[model samples]
Target: MGCSPTRHRSQLSKLDSPSKLDAPCITQERSIETPGVSPNRKLLLAYYANETTMNGKLKGLFEAIFAKEELEVTTIDLSYHNLNVREIYHLQFVLQNFQNLRELKLNNTEITSKDIKRLYSSLELMPMMQVLELQGNAICNEGIKYLTKLFFRTMKSLKVLNLSNNRFGDEGIATLCKGLLSLRCLEELRLNSNNIYSRGLILLSQTLCQIKTLKRLGLAGNPIDFESVRVLVRSIRSNVNLKELDLSRNGLSKQVKYMLPEGQAVIKA
Candidate 1:
């Protein structure tokens, strides 16, 4: 991601403009590798972001991208980047230019409450967005406020959302269920490893009943009990549309397997 100092530096000598002073000060170009993909590729994506900084040439890289006459970018995935709040905030500058974006993935980016709010605010720029992946972030109960708000706002356009591995606990799952209950079009939800307890399952069961469009639910690796399993099955009895409900690692009793909808449920091994 090294930029030719002579050309790029000259083009962005005054990268700090007064108009952008009010925007959140996010970090880009922290010592890291380039987000290089094919120029003709429609997706600008990255993986293993947890190992190194996703920042490289902030001004130069995107400047070149925007300078092109034909814009092919539709999806931007920066999963496992281990980004800080400021680093996440700084992405608004680049995202603003990618108005036609359809999917955005920020899994394992160390996102917190304030960072999520900043990310949510940037959604206004992505009107066509359909899929949002925020798995493995640090967003706990308090951090879900922005996400809930995001769900409310994007009900029409958002279809698939993954929030796995965030450890939201029982309280956080309850809060998250509030948002899930209102989604009219969301089809897939991944909430694996979120410290879910009986209370969370109860709330989640109710949410499943409410959201008629939800088809796939990833409920693996939680702390669910036998009673909760029965409650969950009963709550979603009317949801014949449910295609798959994965409860792989929850350590539920063997008897619970009979309670689930025979063909649709995937119980523990």
Candidate 2:
């Protein structure tokens, strides 16, 4: 189900600034290529610095961003916006219009499980998506279920996935592992600062051993003890494709580093 990149002609377009001075505006636009995607893609970088102004004028901002050439937009970064119920719906509506979206960043948006369910449903439209970052949100095990559906149904072209700082626990990791098995092209997976422990790491380690395309893994800031680290090392000991393993800030002793499998991956404990 992985999406193959096809060449497309590139074009640039600009949006008219909203009349109201308080509304968020499009500050920058450029053409950039993802590592494995097509080079002819436009990236729309919209910065809503003031949360109050953004909240009040969310509709106008979305209108301006997706005004005329929604199909040409390849990447969208709306991080740090504290989206509400109505605003999430507005985002979901606009997302369906993006036919070639490759990267979507919604970090620290205060989105809950209910909001993710609605938002993820729209993601099924963008089968060409490559990168998805949802760090620093409120999604828990329930939200992970919705994402698992995305993994099974679409996003087979995904390369970098960041789900750090979402506060999900062992149950969520277990659910995510099932979806991870289906991603044939995933490279980077960031799960730092979640509520995972020994049990979750054991499951994740087993899954990682099977994903040969995975190169970078971020498990920092979790509460992994020595026993879990040993288990993880043993599980992924033969995974030669894994190049980087980030386990920083988990408070493991220096002796634990020595216990890691030699020459397997660059351990950062």
Candidate 3:
């Protein structure tokens, strides 16, 4: 469904950062007929960037979508859009509307630790949210760790998480593993281009062996060498839940690709 803007004479109040008692919120009403829901019933928010003219417009659009209190999924990319403090602050208000939100994405944005914390604090209101993507932000190990703690503790229903290209190195990946260990429902995890190596990959593979629900794992565009792949394969050989793995754009040898576990698929080269 296409969006037709109706200019309502709504007040644009200046919002403060969330208080101790306040929660993340939105005031719009959205329906399943929304443009992006799929057969799997996943709410898609990829078109959020192109629909609004500016941040203010985007906020208004979100407000309208959330007021109905029915929106279950949302995806947004805040990259190269001049997202300042006020814009992030407005997002705190926008999220409150998605009490039932299940999927969320904030790819390619210049989010920091503080912004991530803000989002996390709000999502804490919704306990059933599943998939989340935070690719292309500057949230490194510290930020990732912060999210891991919160996600593991609250979002037991979470299934997928994409945290690629966020400057998180091996240490950050390790921190994420700690969270993954506890994610009973998590399925897919994308950790592309965060400066991870064999050690981190091995650690992840080792931990994933214990996670029965995990399915696909993406480790593309990182610095995992042939040796690292060998370690990863060896670590996950005992794991039977993983189905697909992406290791594209890395300089891996063909022999290592064949080393994937039986019934498991690996995408290399």
Candidate 4:
């Protein structure tokens, strides 16, 4: 990664100077999707950018910029933050500028399934979004309902998705897959380390048959067994867009090479 220009870095430093929230966030402009989008839009890299229980300084900065007519924020990443659930939830509402947002990352935020509704409502405001990553949260099946709502709304524009490290079990995974059946635009999916097992694998395998647009699928560090992977292997066999598959740390590792069909060498166990 290259360094930001001196002038911009100087200005951005003042806005997000917490001395401890050393998180780095990147914001790329979607020129084709959102023409005339501001290149100078302020990005909120809320990765615990300070040593406070709550994001007091970050909240203050957000309020200052929100006072303007057109909000300038395009990215809000709260990964590895110390903010409580309420503070994290409140940040969603204060993000008055959503029309220009193209990426949303909230990894390791300690968010639960109950906060999905508020997050979904916030989703409606960002139409140009192309990437949505919510890894390492506490979201369960109940929270997936709100995620499906957002998916139904943004399925047309979303191209990249990551929901790994959540508590979405078989039922939850199946529900999510049901909603993603028509997400033809999606190209990458990450579901590693989410406690998925045979049932979840079966449901995902069924759904994978219908999703032919995904190029990368990550299911590493799960509880998948030989029987669980049989259907998934078959489903992926017919997929033309799939280029990489990560199945390491799962139960299928020992027999993975023998289980997969001939000439299919992209999978990693």
Best by lDDT: 2
Decide which is better by lDDT, 2 or 3.
2
**TM-score list, all predictions:** 0.73, 0.77, 0.73, 0.75
lDDT of 2: 0.74
Put down candidate 1 lDDT per residue, 1-269, tens digits, no spaces.
11111111112133433334322222232222236544422233222212133344343334345345244456666665555544564576457545667777888666666666676667756657778888977677767766777677654567788888878778888888888765677888898888888889988887787877777788789888878878888877777677777787877646666676677655542
CA RMSD of all predictions: 12.1, 10.5, 11.5, 9.3
Backbone clashes for every candidate come to 7, 0, 16, 1
TM-score ranking of the models: 2, 4, 3, 1
RMSD of 4: 9.3
lDDT of 4 by residue, 36-129 (tens): 3243233343432342434644555444453442335566666765445456455664444456677777787667776665666667777677
For candidate 4, the 10 contiguous residues with the lowest summed lDDT are 1-10
lDDT of candidate 2 at residue 83, scale 0 to 100 = 73
Greater-TM-score candidate between 1 and 2: 2
Evaluate model 4: give its lDDT.
0.67
Lowest-sum lDDT 10-residue window in model 1: 1-10
lDDT order, best first, reads 2, 4, 3, 1
Off by over 4 Å in 2: 1-67, 259-264
For residues 102-149, could you state the per-residue lDDT of candidate 3 as single tens digits? 766667556776677777777777677777878876786667767887
**Positional deviation of 105 in candidate 2, in angstroms?**
0.4
How far in Å is the alpha carbon of 23 misplaced in model 2?
Answer: 13
lDDT measured at residue 161 in model 4 versus the true structure, 0 to 100: 84
